[model samples]
Target: IEGGLLASPPPHQYEFARLNLTYVITSKRKLAQLVYDHKVNGWDDPRIPTIVGLRRRGYTPEALQLFAERIGVTKSDSWIDYSTLEGCLREDLELKAHRGMAVLNPVKLVMTNWDEVMGVGHLEPCSQPALPHAPHGASSDAAPEGTEPPPARHFTIGKEVWIDREDFEEVPPKGYKRLFPGNKVRLKGGYVIECTGCTKDANGLITEVLATVVPDTKSGTPGSETVKVKAAITWVGVANGVNAEVRLYDRLFLDAQPDAGGKDFIESLNPNSLKVITAKVEPSLANALPGQNFQFERHGYFVADRVDHVQGRNPVFNLAVGLKDSWGK
Candidate 1:
C-alpha cells in the first residue's frame, strides 16, 4: 500500500499534535455527529471548540497565543481546565475592550424626579470613560502628579433607564447592596437615585421601580463624587438605548469529563446552555460593527456576531465569557 504512489512521493510529513482542552471533544466523528444530530446549532456554534467557533466567540489571536505559551509542549497527555482559556481572553481584553452598559434581563426604572430636573421629554447628558481602568492617551503610571484625568465621553439619558432585573430585590438578601425601597444607588455615568418603591401588576411581578434622583448627583457634576453609595449599577436609557438580541452561551456539557469512564457524552448535554434574550444597550453600541468586542459592565464580555450583525438594523451579540469570579464552583 505504501509503495503504490511512489512516483509522486510526498515531500514532508509531520506528526499529528493534540490539545487536551477540558469540557470539549475534538473527535471528528463526534463533532460530525453533533452537527448532523442537531445537538448544537452548527459547527460554528460558539459553544463548540472549533476554530471558527472560537473566532466568532471573540477569542483574540493574542489570547490564543498566550494560551499556547501557558500550556507549553508536553510529551504526556494532559488536560487544561476551560477556565484557563477564559482567563487568557480576560487578560487580553482587560486593557483593550471598551466599556459599555447592556442590561440582559432589563427591568424598568422610572426616575420620578427626572421631569423635575430636565423637564418632560428632555434628555439628560451623561458620560463614562471609554476605558474605565486605563487612562486615555497615557499609561496609568505616566500621568503627572496633581493632574486631573481626561473627561469621559458623553451619552444621553431620559426619564427612564433599563437596569438588570437581578439588580433589584423585593426582599433583600444578606449583604445585598443594590436597589430596594429607600436604598440609594448610583447609575453608572448617570445620577444617584434613591428608590422610593416599586409597582407590581396583578400577577405580583414588578412592573416598574420608582426612584427619586439625588440633587446634583449627575456623574462629573459638582457634588457627584461626594454622594457615596454602597453599590453602583449599570443602565441603558430607554429613549436612547438600542435593542439587541444577546445570546448567552454557557457550557455545552454539565459534566467536566463527559466522555470519561466510558460515559456517553450526549447524555451529559446541558439543556440550559444557550439562552436568547433581548438586551437594552447604550446608544453607542448601535453602530457596533461585526466582530466588535465590549465588556458589558458587571455582566460579561460579548461580541457583535460576525455572521448575523447588520449595522442600522437589529444587532445580534454572543457572550464570550464572564468575569473570572463570576461563576460559583
Candidate 2:
C-alpha cells in the first residue's frame, strides 16, 4: 500500500520462496527418517539413485546421462512414467556391458568320464575373447557422443562347471528348459551337454548331475553344431573358477508409491528383495577392484561391493539388476 515509502527489499521475500519448495514430498526430513529407521540406509545405499549409489548398482555413466536427457530439463512435478527410465537404461546396456557366466544356486556337475575323456585336473582354457570389443572410433561406427566406452574384460571361462540348482527338476514343469533326467540344454558360452543322470541324497535333494558334453558343438569353432533346445544354462569352472558370495538385491519396496497409503514405509518392504549366497565367478574376476561392473550373463549386472568385496579372500558382489523388464510395476 505504501510503494513509494518501501526504500529497501523486504526481508521476508526469500522466506516466502522457501515455503513453496518446502511442501515437496521428497523433503530432506522425510528421507532422513527413512534412513534412520533403516527403511533405507544413507542416501548412497545401492537402492537409491544418487550418483554413488547408481555407480555401485552397476549403472554405466552413459546410462545416467541418457536418462537425464530423455526426461528433459524441466521444473514441473508431474510423474514421468517408469518405462522412460527402462528404455534409456536398456539402450546403454546393450553395448556397455559384457557377458560372464555365473550360477546363483549351484547344482554339482560330476563328469563320470573325467578320467577317460580328459584326465582330472587337466584344465582347459575356457574363455570368451569376443567380448570387451573395442568401441567404434571417430571415423568408424558405434560410438555415442559424450559417452566413454566400456572397459575391456579379461575374464576366463571353462568346462565342468556348476549349474544353478533351480535349473534341474526331477519332475518337469510345463515350460522348463534346463537339466531334468534324460533332458538336454546347452551350457551357455560353453557347449551342449545332455543330462543323462543325477544323484540325490536321502532327503531327495539332488547331490550332483552327470552330463556328457556334446563332442562337436563348441561355439564359434568351424565344426560347431547348434542343438535344438529351448534352454541354455550357465556355469562356472570348478578347477579354476573363483568362489565368491553374490548378493542379489531387488527393489526395496513392493509398491511403486512406497510412501503412499498412509502406511509406514517399512511396511511395504519386500522380504525377498535380497538373497546372499556363496557362488562361483570367473577366475579373472578375482582381481576386480571395488565397484567394477559386469553383467553376470544370464543372471544380472553386478558390481564389486565397496564395503564387503575382498579381492582375494572372499569376494562379494551385489546383483544390480536382471537383464529383463521387471521394475516399477
Candidate 3:
C-alpha cells in the first residue's frame, strides 16, 4: 500500500520557543485506518493527536507554544506525561481568555424575594471585567500601556437563574459552602443570596432552589455587600442565558503507552472521550466569534467551534482543558 499521507497537515514552521523542540510522531497510515473505519470522525476529530485535531479541539497557538517550550527537544526517545501538555494550555489561557458563566448540568434557582427587593419582573444589570487579570499586568492579550481597560461583560440578573446542578444539595456534606438550606453564598459578580428552601419533584429530585437576594449587592460585589459569604457560585440568568451545545473532551487513550511492543492501540481507546451536553451560557457569549476562547468561570476553558458554532444562534464549544489536571488521581 502506498503511503496515503495526503491527509496529514502540510509541513509548516511551528515558530515556538526560540530553542529547538521535538514533538510526538504519529503514524499516518494508522490514523487513516481509524478514520476510514469510522472509529474516529475524521482527521479533524478532537480525539486525534494532530494539528488539525488540536485546533478543532480549541488548542490555541499560544497554548501550543507554551507546551513546546515546556517540553524541550530531547535527543533520545522519551515519554512525556499528558498532564504537562494540559497544564500548558491552562496556564496560557488563564492569562488571556475572557471570563463567562456556563452551567453544564443546570437546575432552576429562584430568587423568591427578587420582586420584593428589585421590583417585579425587573432584571438588574450587572457587569464584570472582561479580563479580570488585566489590572494585575498578567493579561497576555491586553492592549497598549496607555490604552483603556478592556471592555467589561454586561449581563442582567432576573428573578430566576441557572446554577450548576452540583452547586446545590439538600443534604450538605461536612463543609459544603454552596446552596443548602439557610446557607449564604455570593453569586459571583451578582449578589449575596441566602438559601431559604427548595422545591422538589415527585421523585425527590430538587427542581428549584429558593433564595433571598440581598439589596445593594448587585455588581461591586464583596465591597458593596454587607453580607459576607465563604463561597461564590457561578450562575447564568435564565431570562437571557443562551442555550448552547458544549462538548466535553477527555484523553483518548486509557493506557499511557498504547500500541507499544506490537500492542493493539484500538483496545485502549477511551470510550468516554467526548460527551455532548446542552449548557446555559451567558448572553455575552452569544456574540462570541468562532475560534474565540473563554473561561467558563467555575468550568474550564472552552472555545467556540469554528465549523459548528453560529453567533447568536446555535453555539458550539469544545473543552480545551480543565481548570486543573485531575488525571490518575
Best by lDDT: 1
Better of 1 and 3 by lDDT: 1
- Arrange candidates by TM-score, highest first: which order? 1, 3, 2
Clashing pairs in 1: none
- Model 2 regions lying over 4 Å from their true place: 1-25, 73-76, 81-83, 130-160, 226-231, 261-263, 327-329
Q: TM-scores for all candidates?
A: 0.89, 0.78, 0.88
* Clash pairs, model 3 backbone: none
lDDT tens digits, residue span 1-329, model 3: 24876555656664432321112226787778788998888889887778889888888788888887878875555677777877888888876788899999999999998999889999988888778776457464566568876688889999999999899988899989899989999898888899998998899988999999988876574556577788999999999999999999887778777766677878888888889999999988888999898999977999999889999888999998889877667
The list of candidate 3 runs beyond 4 A from truth reads: 1-25, 135-142, 146-148, 221-223
- Lowest summed lDDT across 10 adjacent residues in model 1 is found at 135-144
Show model 1 residue runs off by greater than 4 Å. Answer: 1-17, 135-153, 325-328
Per-residue lDDT, model 3, residue 228, is: 70
Error of 2 at 126 (Å): 1.6
Tens-place lDDT digits, model 2, residues 1-329: 27676656644532211111111124466666767877666776776545666677677768778877876654444455444654566677655555567777787786566456555556554556324443542432234677654443334333467778888888889987788877878766566778878888999888898887675666666666657667777778777677888877776667666565475666777877667788887766776678777778776677888877788776888877667767654
lDDT of 1: 0.85
